[model samples]
Target: MAEVSNKQVIFKDYISGFPTDADMYITTSTISLKVPEGSKAVLVKNLYLSCDPYMRPRMTYTTDSYVDSFKPGSVIEGYGVAKVLDSGHPNFSKGDLVWGFTSWEEYSLITSTEMLIKIPTTDVPLSYYTGILGMPGLTAYAGFYEICTPKKGEYVYVSAASGAVGQLVGQFAKLLGCYVVGSAGSKEKVDLLKNKFGFDEAFNYKEETDLVACLKRYFPEGIDIYFDNVGGKMLDAVLLNMRVHGRIAACGMISQYNLDKLEGVCNLINIIIKQVRMQGFVITSYYHLYPKYLEMVLPHIKEGKIVYVEDTVEGLESAPQALIGLFSGRNVGKQVVVVARE
Candidate 1:
């Protein structure tokens, strides 16, 4: 077996509040190209890495999250597109392309192969395996259809609308003939939501002082479906503007992830008064729906009925900053870091 240089992003330490590039460091190491004998590990050369909001919680010393925290002085693990180099696992082979839980490095020896899935085809951009064709795509599909239970001509509202899951949710609602509105952090993101994703309307959430009143203005008849990506005041505001028997899919709470103490929502009473349903879901629970989602989305993508946007940065060296940018809304769309061209 041959050994090769592997460049990696190391988590320097557990963090509190917002994460910066300083929280991680770049380093080089060596790894054998072959998987060890009698092990079920798969060795891969990483091609692309995903930057997602859920990763923020893993940076803390301890978190009440579905995933484990990133270890200090160790590699940051995430979903990535990779080519199999060697494998002791029967399911994978040399040269096979896959996407799943991989380290932020040029190469990885992954033992937890449960999340790993072979890339079905390369007809679409391989980078898409880190976004639209991967986790975020399934998240939007399951959250909207299964959780929200949307209907035609219903009023839909999405928060953090230009981010990975939100963008797809807005588009999915529109395709179902629902009247969709979304809220993003910047004017540029707002424009992309309305023009690129085909939402009926989009607004910049940062400019709104009274979020409750702002929601009322956009959704006069009240929102029937709410995709809550950013929690805190925005969720409280939306609760007050939800129609009777409304459904809310709480995919994430990006706004509270960085805070030491989370903000409170003062509208719990509204849930009872409006008779609404709100559910918080982890995408891992919905991975079983991938094949069905792919069949439904692929034709729409090929025909230009569905579109995806990526804000890409190059190289393993850029991974830290690219990930940190997701919290500050520094990225325009789905944030992807290109580790290697192949």
Candidate 2:
């Protein structure tokens, strides 16, 4: 087997507070093109790397969390779209396109095939696997439809509404005939929520002095469902404004990921008083529903019934900054790194 240079994003070390590009370094190492004999691993060429908020938590050293922390001096792991070049696994073969958990490298020997999904069709952009067709997509699908149990004409709110998961949740709410409102950090994102994603109303949370008053103004009748992504003060506010028996889908808390001391929800008592059903979910648990999700979302995508936006940068070298940008609200949409076009 011939060897090729593999460019990688290596995690430097566990750290406190916001992670910078310094946390990850780009390096090149040689790798063989074939999977070793008697090995059941799949050798893949990464096409697109997903920059997700959840990946932030994994950057720290923590056994307290269910997700394992990224090891120092190793290629950071993330969900990406890939092309199999060689395989010792029976389920996969050479030239098979896949999307799932993979390392932040140009080439990877994927030993675990349990989470990997063969890309069903190439008609959609392969990068969709990194966003709309991958983890974030499933997160939104499971969180909104399954967790929130939204009904027609319900009042819905989504924080970080222009983000990968949040954008989809708001649109899904609208599709169900719900009145959707979303909050974002910038006017550009807020405009995207209202004008692009079809949210009934959108606001820049940065401009709001009081999130509780903000939600109350958006939903005078009180929120029926809250798709919370940036939890912190926003979540506390939503807790206070939730209607009786309302549902809350706790997706990702980008606001709390970098903090040493996690923020507490002060209006938790309102959960009991209002009888709100607030549930946090992990997307891995809902992978079984993926086939059903694809069936529903694909048509909506093709028909333009549902739209997705992505902020893409070229090459593996750009990945670290792209991932770091999520916390600062620097990317306009789903941040993706293009490793290989094919």
**Residue lDDT tens for model 1, 1-342:** 768999999999989999987899999999998889999999999999999999999998665678999999999999999999999999999999999999999999999999999999888889888888899999999999999999999999999999999999999999999999999999999999989999999999999989999999999999999999999999999999999999999999999999999999999898999999999999999999999998998888889999999999999999999998999999999999999989
- Write candidate 2's Cα lDDT for 59-136 as tens digits: 888898768999999999999999999999999999999999999998999998998999998888889999999999
TM-score of candidate 1 relative to the true fold: 0.99
TM-scores for the candidates: 0.99, 0.99
lDDT of 2: 0.94
**Whole-model Cα lDDT of every candidate shown, in order:** 0.94, 0.94
Model 2 stretches with alpha carbons more than 4 Å out? none
- Model 1 deviation from native, Cα RMSD in Å: 0.8
Error of 1 at 30 (Å): 0.6
